[model samples]
Target: MAGSGETSEARALGEALAALRRDCGLSQAEAGARIGMTGQGWGLYEAGKRSSLFRPDVQRRLTGALGATPEALMLQAPGGAAVSTDRPKTSHPDNAPAHGLSARGRAFEGAASDVRRLRLETDELAPWASAGTVLEYALGRWPRRGQGCVIQLQDGLRKVRLYDRADEAEMVVLGAGALDRSERIARSDVQSVSAVISRLDDA
Candidate 1:
């Protein structure tokens, strides 16, 4: 959650970026010209913090112009602090609790530490986005892109994934016998998914 002051403070950081440019005595056009977004790009970047998808090159230029560290500019961003750097590799510096799994085995045994980790806010799994969670997703096609789609959903009984956003009660059916049929359809021209929770509701 955003602290009441976080968004405002972030905008202030944008303001700082603008001031840094001016202190360097370059017009927005001139400053942006050196970068690539143009003066218009500079204005948008500083004033409208809402739009933050900038190219890595642009980020590098702005970082240099602002005389501020990238970390300083991106503090506590909800989408995440903008950076051009590659993701930090995972490491288990803390030895595992006396569990059977080794450090390597434990990497994915619990909560993921990166973006996915953010989405898992509940021990029992939440149906909606939580503090650190991204929605669970399924890959399939409706009508448009046959390649696949990403939908918010969850798995049940350790064998199924669901597409809760699909307007219909469609769940990824997994099992050994009848489920083999749907799994086959999913691999090809599957029109709709089956809903399994209905039967398990009383369970």
Candidate 2:
């Protein structure tokens, strides 16, 4: 349940993100591609339509993709005061399941704070996310249609795919390519899903 105050705040933040991206001279599709999202999906964030855009992890990654910090995306308050970008620290137990991983099964280092990094080890995500590309994803943020995602299975495995849709019994995902073949998986097999927030081409 969201309160009125929160909604207003999200709207302000969204506007800030939009302005910043425009300042960088990137169109919605171009900016979204840098962050593994579709033009429409990124537009939603800028339109202040998705409440999840307020999440600290999401904020960090989105702004980071634009070469800015989270603080830079904060909206001004009443009387022109600046909103704080501070966020509470997230805690996880030592034995808790990690948020994500690389395709090679190696643990992603330094992603414990906000976003996880996964290196593409195969050509399955080619062109869009080719081998050697490192992807940044935000935990707890669900990707919109046509957006790429990192899905965690019950067995602790992760897969990167373009999100399609889901129902009570299953989730649909599409492979990255011109064909964009879709696959269906039982809902029971999925443990969680995260939105891929950025793509870094590895040299």
Candidate 3:
């Protein structure tokens, strides 16, 4: 028999999973169908009857079915709320577009001081970003799924890849070659992961 504390934790996790499913506009049955699970089977997780919810693999399967990440599930846990990054759009004369400049060009010109820039010298991240592209990234901002990010290694090497998902021990990223080719990198080897906010083509 399970102890009270363990049971309570399972219930909390269940509630969080339920919240994430709801946020994705999915019913239990619909959400489960994505991963080939039956409605009743999936309900067991939401009802906190299945201890498998405590497993990392199970959490990935459940959340992936709802098109969410495990980190997102934690945010949906008890007393936690979904995080938002929306900001009110503001305009300034200095930020206005200059003649012959495209919208993105103007954005690059007016990027915030805190935004760090990097120049790509390879086609590793081709199609998304190519050689000679200038990338503007925010140092501490987390990247949304499919967004570009700069992953800096502890050894001072940097990799530009599309952000996938990250857990406590490792981060999965879409690597250099194909968008579907994912690579898992240990968190210990990472110094920082910065979200790429803008990409400017070389002049």
Candidate 4:
């Protein structure tokens, strides 16, 4: 049940999304696969069937995949500015190439406050974070027990796990969902740990 303004915005957003996808030469299914969703699921966004497109987290994933911005999609404009309908010139982030296709695109400008985006690659943390899910992790935020986290180990291995507990000597993490698995690793083996602040829904 959206109001007239909301509905209008939704339609406009959908059209922009559809256009962006086409410009990138990606099919709905291929676009969906990048974010861990089915083609129908992705189409819903372009069809303006789901309100989640208005959500900041969801916008990050959708626009990131398109190599565009929220402004590019007309989702948000600065200082209460009116969104322009002109096609935005796509701009990649400064280090966009280094991260390959995994980096968060210049999209979600307002939502990128000290946040970095990473795509989940495995289902080890399934249900909570299955493969294809996109995670927005805070750069320096510490994770409390029972929170999702990205752990970078000294040996250069990175893992996504639910934070269990941590001490000066070691850290404990549990597999999310019904996996019923846990592991403890020495603190010395860890390089960094950051809290996963938000997950973009591709479901």
* Number of the top-ranking candidate, with lDDT as the measure: 3
| lDDT (tens digit, per residue) of candidate 3 on 1-203 | 98887787778878888987787688888776554568888899998899877664466557655645455666677755332112212321334421110112112333356479999888878888888999998753456568898887877788899987765567788956777799988877876566789999977
Compared with the true structure, model 3 gives a TM-score of 0.47
Better of 1 and 3 by lDDT: 3
The stretch of ten residues in a row with the least summed lDDT in candidate 3 is: 98-107
Clashing pairs in 3: none
lDDT of 4 at 196: 88
Please provide TM-scores, in order, for all candidate models, with all chains considered together: 0.30, 0.46, 0.47, 0.44
C-alpha lDDT score of every prediction, in listed order: 0.35, 0.67, 0.68, 0.66
- How many times do residue backbones clash in model 2? 0
- The whole-model C-alpha lDDT of candidate 3 against the native structure comes to 0.68
Instruction: Give the clashing pairs for model 1.
Output: 118-132, 118-133, 119-132, 119-133, 119-134, 140-149
In candidate 1 the C-alpha lDDT for residue 134 amounts to: 39
Error of 3 at 4 (Å): 21
Select the stronger candidate by lDDT from 2 and 4: 2
- Candidate 4 lDDT over 1-203, as tens digits, reads 77887777676778778987887798998777554568898899998788877764456557655655455566432222253332332443443321211223333455366588899878888778888999998643456557787877767788889987654457778994445787888866765566788999677
